[model samples]
Target: MLPEAKYRFLSEDVKRRSGLVLGPEKGYLVESRLAPLARTEGLASVEAVIDLMMRGDKRLCEAAAEALATHETFFFRDKTPFDLFSEVIAPALKPSRAGRAMKIWCAAASSGQEPYSLAMLIDEMSGLRADILATDLSGKVLEKARAGLYTQFEVQRGLSIQRLVKHFDQAGENWQIKPELRAKVRFEVGNLLDDFSRYGRQDVIFCRNVLIYFSVEEKAKILARLAGMLADDGYLVLGAAETVVGLTDALKPAPGQRGLYVKADSGASAPVVFRSATAAA
Candidate 1:
């Protein structure tokens, strides 16, 4: 067990820099995430790792950041959000823009699963012109996303047997994503707490399950930046349990959809008034 002082130090460091709150229940997560780095550095424990990490050493700091950012994600882990994307979000793109192409951003795309899942949905739409921009804080996962490979179990989670057989080809014990789907997604490095100017305009943003790691202030800041990238009519989709209430009024709850938010019109300065555009039309 990490000493109380050590835990407080590490937790405070993480919270200060990344806004990731580390409570007592998540100590094991810290140990597991940082153990590999400690091992590589010939350190004996998480305490020693923390000592080295806090010394203003850029390299150690980066390693610690990567460890904290590494997380688990599976293909179509939650079907409802993707279903919302397909049925509500995707269809809402202007008809005149059908062949003009649409942009989808998957923030914190771990190992490519979520973005690839979005690609699958896009492919299912016979005539929609869409592409996926998947980004992560870790370069390691971004490379994996670019490679489009996954272990059998990684591919299986949240993916039905039919999707598995249809979208992935077996390579020994691993499954490789089909080229057609892989071709539609482009992966790059991104910091959710930093500027997203490189991402260009987006019609849909999938920032699922990421904000829970951030402090409330950080969540609000991220929502503001994300909302800026959205077109006036674009949508933001967060994790099922996450919400933008009290974070930003720029995003209004998308009517009849549980986890969807639409960007409020420019020049507006209040908590978004929830109105169903579909109903209004």
Candidate 2:
């Protein structure tokens, strides 16, 4: 176990770099997350990892942050948002972008599932041309996403058997996303704490489930940046548990939609409104 002081310091360090808050109760998490890294670096213990990190070992500190920052995500996670994308957002956004390619940004894309799922949906549309840019804080996960490979359990989660057979090729016990689907999306390492202006405005932004880790102040700041990066009529999809309420004035709930948000100035009207329905379990 890491000493109380060292655990506090490590917690603060993680927040400084990644905006993930870890309280004293998370000491076990800290120890478990960093123990393997310590071993891989030939350090004797988690305390040794912390010692080097506190001593200005940039690499060790980053490794610790990445380990702690990793989170679980599955394909088509929280079906409501994807359902809204397919049933409402896509059909509505298509006409406005008749001649140009629509851009979608999967912010906080852990591994590849979320963005790849979007790619599959877009490919199914007859006249829609779309590009998906998926970003994550951890380079390790981004590499895995770029490889487009998944174990059996990964493919089984939320992936319909027909979709799986259509989009993936078997490789031993794992499945690799088809080359066409893989080619439609690009993966990069991005930190929400940093500037995102360079990615250009996106037609749809999926920043789901990631904001719950941040403080309210950080959430507002991140939402402001997202608002700036969205097109006038673009859609924003957050996790089912997340919302724009009380966070920032830059976004408002899309009327009748459960997990969808829109830029506040986008002139949302009754014609686009639809009542919320329960997401598939």
Candidate 3:
């Protein structure tokens, strides 16, 4: 078990670097998440890993923070958001971008499923030229995503057999997405805490299931930046568990839809207030 002091320091460090707010009660999480990294480094305990991190081991510290990231994802996770993309967003954007390519950003794309899923949908659409960019905080996950390979269990999660056979080929026990499908999207390492201005105006942004880890203020800040990056009619999809209601008015729930958020009338941000991650729980 980590001492309360060490745990607090770790939680704050994680917040500073990654915007993930691990409150004091998450000591067990820090211990468990860093254990494998500890063993890999031949350190005796997670405490030793933290001690080195506190001592200014920059590389190890970033890896430890990356370790805390929740990479739990599967193809077409939660269903509705992808449906909204294909059924609503895509059809709406096709006309406006009749000659140009549509830009889609999967901001927190954990292991590529989200962006790859988007790619597959785009493949099915006729006369729609789209560019997909998927990014994550961990370089390790981006490597896996770039490879476009998934285990049987991973493919089975949300992929139907028809889509699976259509998009992937058996590589031993794993399935690799077809080369053409893989080429449709680009994967990169990105941090939501950094400036997002370089991405330009995106037609759609999928940042689902990511903001719940941040404190209220951090979530608000991220949403405000995302709003600026969004096209006038662009949609932002968050996890079903997350909402922009109390955080920022820069975004509002899309009418008659569940997880999609669109810009508010003023297209401006409201003030953010400090809210503890623990209290949010």
Candidate 4:
């Protein structure tokens, strides 16, 4: 167990660097996540790792932050959102924008599943040209994402047999995304708390399942920043469990889509009704 003073410092340091709020009860998580780093760095214990961090070791601090940040993800997570994207968003975008390419940003794209899924959907559309930018705070996971490799179990979780055969090629026991699909996404290491002006205006932003770790104030700050980066007609998709309600007025829920929000100034249009084929099952 980490000493309380060290725990508090580490927690505060993580929040300062990454905006992830580690509560008192998360001491176990801290120990579990950092202990391996401690072992690898030849430190006596997690406390020793913390001491090294306190002494101004920037590398250890960054590794600690990466260790604690959640990277949980799977392909087409919560299928309804992808369905809505393919059915409503894609068709609406193609005609509306004429010849311009659509830009989609997956702000917390852990290991590439989310953005790759978006890429696949975009590839299926006849006339829509889309670019996908997938970003994460951890360079380690970003590296993994760029490689486009996954275990059988990971691929099985959210991918159908058709998509599996169509997009991935066998690489020993693991599956690697085919070169054509892999080429569609660009991965970068980014911190959501930092300025997003580099990403410019996005047509759609998927910052899903990431806000739950943050304090309400941080959530508001991130959402407001996202709002600033969003185009007037852009859509922002949050996790099913998350919402902009009572958090920030910068975004309002889309008229008929769950987990979808539009900029407050975007103006209301006829609601797009999405009925997922698999929802009945």
Best by TM-score: 2
- Tens digit of per-residue lDDT, candidate 2, span 80-107: 8888989999999999999989999999
lDDT of 1 by residue, 1-281 (tens): 88888788788877777777889888777876787678778999778888876677667777786677656788887888999988887777747467688888999898999998988877778788787899999898889888887766567579888888888888775688888888899888988988887889898899999899999999999898888889887889999899998999778777678988887663343345687779755
Candidate 3, superposed: residue stretches over 4 Å from native: 1-70, 266-281
Candidate 2, poorest ten consecutive residues by summed lDDT: 267-276
- TM-scores, all candidates, are 0.70, 0.73, 0.71, 0.72
Report the candidate with higher lDDT, 2 versus 3.
2
lDDT of 4 by residue, 18-133 (tens): 88999999876777667668877998989999999999999999999987885657899999889989877777667877788899999999899999999888877788888899
Cand. 4 TM to true fold = 0.72
Q: What digit string (tens of lDDT, one per residue) describes model 3 on residues 123-166?
A: 88899978899988989888889999786767988999999989
Residue 247, candidate 4: alpha-carbon lDDT: 88
Best by lDDT: 2
Model 3 scores a C-alpha lDDT of 0.86
**Top-down lDDT ranking:** 2, 4, 3, 1
